[model samples]
Target: MIIDITCRTDRFNLSAVGPHFINDCCFGEDFSRWLVGALRRTGVDASVIGMEDFGWSNQATLDGTTYLVCVAGNSDALADNPDRGEWHVMLERKRSLMQRLTGEGKTSATDPLVRRIARVLMEAGLVEVGVEA
Candidate 1:
């Protein structure tokens, strides 16, 4: 299976650090590194696909994978795998449950995690960043 991990690539998509998941991470830089490492651990090949004003997409190429996993500014993980693999299932499941449940009992979370991840990717020398807000 394959998954896409997207995040807000916007250099000015910032808001108050609410008491939600959005407040936890905000496109810092550590998140992205974690992502790359996570995928690496799972034997997945992930590539950054640049960003728009406030969005970016990641390509997770797993074992013979050819699908997508898209995350957004305030979005979750999107895994598309024709042949669901065990590794993919576990990896995705962990992320889904952690992210969704972590922000429980709260309004919409403009998930800073994704953005923070983008920042991390930039610093890790994996993704080249133009500007940050």
Candidate 2:
């Protein structure tokens, strides 16, 4: 499932005129790392896997289920409003070969980590766009 969001960069210590990433990544990269850290702090096993063209790739395991996460979008801070930015967050279950062939293990908003991540973003003050928040 995908969740679109708009947020204030100050919440994540991001600045338009300053460094945008933590470790040689793209605009939204730091935020992705921040999320993984947040999840870890909450006792969730999450980690940043790598960078993606759009943003960053991450992986998280919960209850023996692995989930692939991508937080991507136009994270460019507006020139007139550097604190504001947007993101497209996606999460999917990594299906086994048999499950993939059988068309099972699909993820949705109701999934545990999906709902948890959504709540995390909301609690962090990001506003969900074009969907129920």
Candidate 3:
């Protein structure tokens, strides 16, 4: 079945897209949901980086479709190999740097306390970080 993903361009512009995505991914077929969840706070920053790296703009349009340009790692690429420590570490470093530069502290779409609580649940076997691979 096709997902109901839409080009909610305005939400991304307001830095809300990342937050919105965290929950949508939890139950999706691609079981490596944490990859997307981990990125909840950094998506906006990635978008800005895209502006420099790919000459992507903070704003863009194609064939009358407008979009807020955000750098979400490719789902297809990630789904193939989900748990590489190197990628996690690299992304964390980038996220740290971006936070300092932007002066916009990172808060997961969920609060930090909530994330910790959920982590505990997953660790205790009440939940699982499902592996799509």
Candidate 4:
């Protein structure tokens, strides 16, 4: 399963004093940091991998299943106006080399927690959210 999210940058405020403080910890830096923090808060083992061309990446493991979260935004647009556009986010299962070679874990199983993660953002006032297989 792959969770896809598209939301405005202003919708997720990082400042606690901001009006959108309800989402202060929801999305940031393309959502890698936020996802890692959110997952950990939920008792899931998650860590940020590193930065990417348009955003950042992270890995989370739950019940022996690993997931890779990739987040990105329009650099040019953000550079011109920080809170002007939407950010794109995706969460997909990660498989080890053995699993890939053996054609296992090719598709992600429906994970309730993953849905919870998506729900959090949706309820936080995201512009759009979808789950893909």
Best by lDDT: 2
Q: What is the Cα-based lDDT of residue 58 in candidate 4?
A: 79
**How well is each residue in 19-85 modelled by candidate 3, as lDDT tens digits?**
3244322112121133234333433222222222211223322233223322222122234344211
| Candidate 1 wrong stretches, greater than 4 Å | 1-33, 75-133
Residue 67, model 3: lDDT of 31
Error of 1 at 17 (Å): 12
Q: Best to worst by TM-score, what's the order?
A: 2, 4, 1, 3
C-alpha lDDT (0 to 100) for residue 103 of candidate 3: 61
Global CA lDDT computed for model 2 = 0.65
| After superposition, candidate 3 runs with Cα above 4 Å error | 1-100, 107-120, 127-133
Error of 4 at 45 (Å): 1.7
Tens digit of per-residue lDDT, candidate 1, span 51-85? 32323334555444222333333422324322111
Q: What lDDT tens digits, residue by residue, belong to model 4 across residues 3-103?
A: 66555545443332334333333334536677678778877888888755445677878788777777765422455455555666677777788987887
For candidate 4, the per-residue lDDT at 59 reads: 80
TM-score of each: 0.32, 0.75, 0.16, 0.65
Q: So what's the TM-score on candidate 1?
A: 0.32
Best by TM-score: 2
Would you list the C-alpha lDDT of every candidate in the order shown? 0.35, 0.65, 0.26, 0.62
Task: Sort by lDDT, best first.
Answer: 2, 4, 1, 3
